[model samples]
Target: MKKILIVEDEKDLAENLRDLLEALGYVVVKVFDQAQFVLEYLKTEAVDLILMDVMIKGSMDGIKLTEEIKKSHPIPVVFITAFSDQGVLERISKGKYEGYLLKPFSLQALKSAVFLALNKHAILEKDLEGASKNSLKIRDKGYVVPVSQDDILFVEADGLYSKIVTIQKTYVLRGILKEISKNLDPKKFVRVHKSFTININQVTSLNAKELVIGEHIIPIRRGFYKSLLGLIKLN
Candidate 1:
């Protein structure tokens, strides 16, 4: 069962929602009217979903609270608002909620929206885990090989596959260059060429046209040269 937090100013409506969620085999962790209280509670509590009201009787609105929560950690938020004005809709869109429901929503709609939000949130977490470079698992032949971030020398793009070059050997994996580049640690890996992402720690020499990492000579595109040089110089 997933835990849910309800942030609504209307006490009667909050109770109704709690009862509905409880009946649907979901846990209602807390019903908070103010944003600060919710934030304070979350310091020690874990919740899977948040049902938030767009307008609340407090200093901080639901959108602002969600923004603050996202900076530290991301939780699926579903906005429930009575206001149907253009301004309210605009604010809801800016919040980027997984789902939204108008006032006096049906039980079926609420259930579907909540289920979709939770399912999507789970998928997002799996994608983040896959993209993270902290002890990445790469499929090498028939074995799943674990590679540390510090062990990588550079990544070179082959037509549709990517080559992970280490001090020992090179491994070919099925992935695009651009997607592979985004998964690497930005501080350690720098894209000198359109088809190559070089580990700064492995780079021994650099110039306007190319950069040398160990024995490999990687070409640096003219478009990426100036900005890359400037960024390195500033650092």
Candidate 2:
């Protein structure tokens, strides 16, 4: 079963989230205060995902807690917030959160977010476990690209197509971001910018403003900066 850690301070909200997740067949673990305790549990056990509240009673806010947790553990996190102001959205997006759950969310919305978050994590784990090395057959082209996962440097959107760039060559395919995202390893490739996806291994370094993949510089979108940092550092 996929285990989840719930980090919300509100008693009623926490219980409601726990019940909802449990009903959906996910094993839920609730942590109401002191996110630092979560840091320890993460070290000892593996958690599939986290549902964190932006405003908590604890000493650390959700963003700060995420920063600390990501330093050593890179589990996927979805922010739960009551405020949906543009400023808050921009801030949350900077964290590269898997998804967001606004307060008073419907059951369907919460479940959908959970499913997406888990799926993303699963894809990412596959990449880390060597999904990249597997040969991918291009549909109907009879063209089998001789590429290893390690050779992949980055994947970006070129107009309406998705371009897979490796150390040796680039492959342009007909697809949308969602379609391509399903095939690539999530752990290895992340959509940091709206138009670009990058291989985590190819990242030589990350500046506050841009991602450096060899000589190529990719600008980090304001919303994906935090999540990108987590992936870069954790991986």
Candidate 1 lDDT by residue in tens digits, 6-61: 99999999999999999999999999998899899988989999999888778999
Candidate achieving the largest TM-score: 1
lDDT of each: 0.86, 0.80
- TM for every model, in the order presented, reads 0.61, 0.55
User: lDDT score, residue 106, model 2?
Assistant: 95
Question: What is the TM-score of candidate 1?
Answer: 0.61
Q: Model 2, 15-110: lDDT tens per residue? A: 888898899999986565567777777878888899989887668888788878877787899999998899878778777568889989999999
Candidate 1 C-alpha RMSD relative to the actual structure: 14.2
- Pairs in steric clash, model 1: none
Model 1, stretches more than 4 Å misplaced? 133-235
